[model samples]
Target: MAATRIWSIKGRLDSVINYVTNPEKTDGGKYTDTELQALADVIDYAEDEAKTHNKVYVSGINLSPNIARDQMVMTKLQFGKTDKILAYHGYQSFLPGEVTPDQAHEIGVELARRLWGDRFQILVTTHLDKEHLHNHFCLNSVSFVDGKKFRGGSKAYWQMRAESDKICAEYGLSVIKNPGKGKNYAEWKAEHENRPTVRNQIKDELDEIIKCSYTYEQFWKILKQRGYAVKRDVKYVVLKPAFSQRYIRLKSLGKNYSEEAIRQRIIAARNGIRDLDKPKSDYNAWLNKYEPTKLHGFKALYFHYLYLFGKIRKKETPQRVSFYMRDELIKFERYQKQFRFLYDNEIETVEQLTIFKENVENKIDEMIIRRSKLYDKTDSKTEIKTINAELRELRKNLRTCNNIFIDAERIREHTEYVARLEKEANEPQKQQIKDYVIG
Candidate 1:
């Protein structure tokens, strides 16, 4: 599960940008050499000390050439330097629900302190006045206290958020809710899937066919029924659906399900023989489908792979895969108590969650079995008991899931940025580039 625990901060960009551009803006309102020195010092310190995964450069200042120069003119940042050393955006994030801005800012400072304790060269700026919610994190990019290289990429960014959440929780602040997968790429993918897409429609149809058809003709007939055009030839069949005109053959499915088998499955399905082949494997059945237990199993597999690859250092495995903890179990019951308020009215939210949790529990049992298999032969009851206890703890945490912040703007912003940049490349950028390069 990718991390999505984002810590977002916003500050006066005008002030900060000005300060960065012109050293004169450093003092109070007017920038000064001292302020510039401070920001540079912070960056240097953070880079040296913060144990970072990657250095990420993100910014929201859309640098229109005309306006860009004006901004720089105000800031006095190498006014005539045309060649951009770097094109980047400055941004901050944590998971969907973690700590708020105040807490997140503090966490940034804490990270600096942890990496370079007592060496203060960190500044958190908010860009609230503008039409965006963003933050400027100017640190030394190194710490004097330690020599951990500051990494600022996606993974490091989330690690920062996770540490923030853990610390915030420790400090008694209202920690934002997170499902361990942190609101990273995977969550964005999930959200994107909810939107209308030709690809999604294709997947949906493919899934239906997977469950219903056992052979090529059966598959073809079903597709035709669902408004596809199919032509059978002597050697092979060509399918021209409303969505595409791709030619598919028996070889496409797999080696075992050859042309002969593909046709056979279709025939069997057409004949209404339910058991076309032996039986679908557990994995094949769950492919392109969503099931809580299966999902939990997948999460288990993912972490196992990550651990094996040494992506993250091994800690006592998290008790809850769905981001639940023992402390919040009772609170969850209360939160959902409203649904039970009309138990007889019989809504199904609680029922669904109950089923999901049960499925998760079953997978945990499965996990134990798998663990036993993977490790050296030790079927000791004590070992099993310990695993079960951890499973229980995991169950308690996942029994109630929380993500306090319900809104997201980053994806939309990224989407717009991509579209606009693509458009610029398509239209106005061509002649400008030709002139700039040739002239």
Candidate 2:
């Protein structure tokens, strides 16, 4: 089965064009990525096809060969329009082992012609890099014959899918009758292979935190503490977990995991509604058990270490005693390393920690500037390889510096919290502080 999706290209049009028309994949103007029988006579033929059909005259076509002329032409057409939509990028992917790359490309070109032949100028390129055969369509927003722009909406998308399904049927390929929902290729591939996806991992973490949280804000804060980057937009709540490079939409998780659903669950829990599916232990009963108290610097470090190493439970410990189970001993050794790091860096005071953080920040800034210059200088393949190697080393150092800075910040925050607990004499305030700290 083949699935189709369309998206608007708002900026950086050149990069997209270059990627889809890279000579290495296209096999030197063979259009090997596509099933098109007509071989391209020149490089970046798909881009050239799009540019030839462009109605608006654009400058610097000869001067800037690296820039996507088609995109530049589209931009010129959109100069006076109120709508800022530049171009539409679409993808048509087929099931692995179902169709050859050539067949996929042929179907893709036919699909585009059927869908937008009369109205839009489209360049269909088949990409053969992935497991499944896929086609990329870089369609001009404005009509070449007429100056009208392609107004895409729900109806247009439905039409596109219908057109693709019809083409796939003609090619004697299977069609997905009920495509309930859609996921990006990577997520789909991961799921198809029965591998644990980043989304599933994030959901597991979210479920754990949601079980303990009483409000949406608290849930978000807990996720942040667990090192998830969260961004709330008008329609969806997106989360990028630690070590992940991409964000997953909450709604895409499923009906039970949408933003509204999560909020409802939080409200239900607050009103004493219990989710029978979740285990009782998932909800931390000792959330408010710890009482934060001001101590001398050494005492603060001692308690922090105990808490850090999980020597003391969330609740009070009868007395501080050191035990050496194999795991405990290993953790103690790690704690000793951290203690040495603090001592060696002179991070005993908040002021010193702040200065150390600033230095790390400055180093990161310097690396970033150096990386930018390297990228700008990369023209040849050898230069690119050399620059990438340097960038990788810089990235490693940056990550180490960032981890250290985060650790210092966490220590400072903990110290400040303890200081605040000492200043608050009211019983209720102290209880609130304890609850905030332990949770």
Candidate 3:
């Protein structure tokens, strides 16, 4: 099957022309790369053609092609008075070993003509450098006859794919029955390489965050705190995680992780309702098995101590949990990590944890102050490098401290909220009513 992908080329007309007509790919001016053996009449190469008298033509309207970077610029100037788009580029690739280079080229030319022959001026080139034979089409965005611009959208892409599939089937080539979902070229390449894609990483992070968050706002806040830059688009949310250069569309993740679905998940979780889409966790089971005697302050601390000393037996654990913590044993292992962090730091009390957090903050502040002084005093690249190295170490240390501090604070808040709920539950109905009204 021949897969098709297309996207608009937005920028200066000259640059686009140069890229499509690169001399190296054109066989050093022999033009063997092209399918039709010659560029279309509408595309002019007068200076390069010498005998053409330095004239460019777009369907009988002659102009200087060389002086203005060839027919692309002329076309842009002619139709650009009404439209903003410059050109469109598309790729049609045949599966490896399915078709010969010559066959692929012929099919590509036919496909291009079928798609944009009447309106746009197109150049089709078959590239043989890759394992899979492919055709590249550089089509003018504006119409030659009426100056109408090509309006591309989701419908246009679907139509293009349908045409391609029909053409491939005509040549006795296999066609993809269900193309399924679309992915950009980079994502496709990364998946083929078995690397974790940005979308997958973001989805994993979102799943973890949703488990801890009680509301939409809290979910957003948690993502931001974890170094993601969230942007609200018209129909979907976009996220640019730390160290990433591009923003990922949430809708592109999948139907299950859409913005509306995530919002519904948050609402359901807040109302104590479980969603089938969400994975079940053993947290409630763990709580029930290890119910606290006192439903007041220090419950979190007491549990941490029990967890740290291996007092919570594995036999008492739940059978199933979320995928990340797949079973009771795995969940206990995760708790052990947190328990060790607290125990190794000697953070047995909330007061001690608070002091430890303050010390870390002060250390971070001291490093920042030192770095600022270094920046002011040094202009040498070597000195700057040394300063940056030191700063990076400090930042790493600070991240560890931040994670511990957040966990400790969460424990404190959760324990206090549970204590308040228990206190209310224990009071008489009339006293509870009076308490609710008092303040």
Top lDDT: which candidate number? 3
Candidates sorted by TM-score, descending order? 3, 2, 1
RMSD of 2: 19.0
What are the runs in model 1 whose C-alpha is more than 4 Å off? 1-90, 93-120, 129-132, 146-208, 214-439
Candidate 3 lDDT, 257-290, residue by residue in tens: 8878999878877788875664433333444554
RMSD (Å) of each candidate, 1 decimal:
24.5, 19.0, 22.4
In order of listing, the candidates' clash counts read 65, 2, 0
Instruction: List model 2 lDDT by residue over 1-439, tens digit each.
Output: 8888888877765556666655445442333434322233212221212223321111111122234445448545554442466667888889998875545665776677678767666666676667887778776677655667788877777888888877665454667554555454435544574334556556655776777898999999988987778888646678877656667778878888987888988888889897676332311222224232733343347346545434222212221121111123223323444444554454555566556666655654554444435433436435534543454444334343444455545555644554454355355677999999999
> Cα lDDT for residue 73, model 1?
34
Clashes of 3: 0
For model 3, state the Cα shift of residue 82 in Å. Answer: 7.5
By TM-score, how accurate is candidate 2?
0.33
Estimate the lDDT of model 1. Answer: 0.37
lDDT of 1 by residue, 26-140 (tens): 1113334454444433221112112332221111111221133244333323333223221112334444434333333334445434532343233433332222222444433
For each candidate in turn, the TM-score is 0.27, 0.33, 0.33
Candidate 1: minimum summed lDDT over ten consecutive residues — where?
402-411
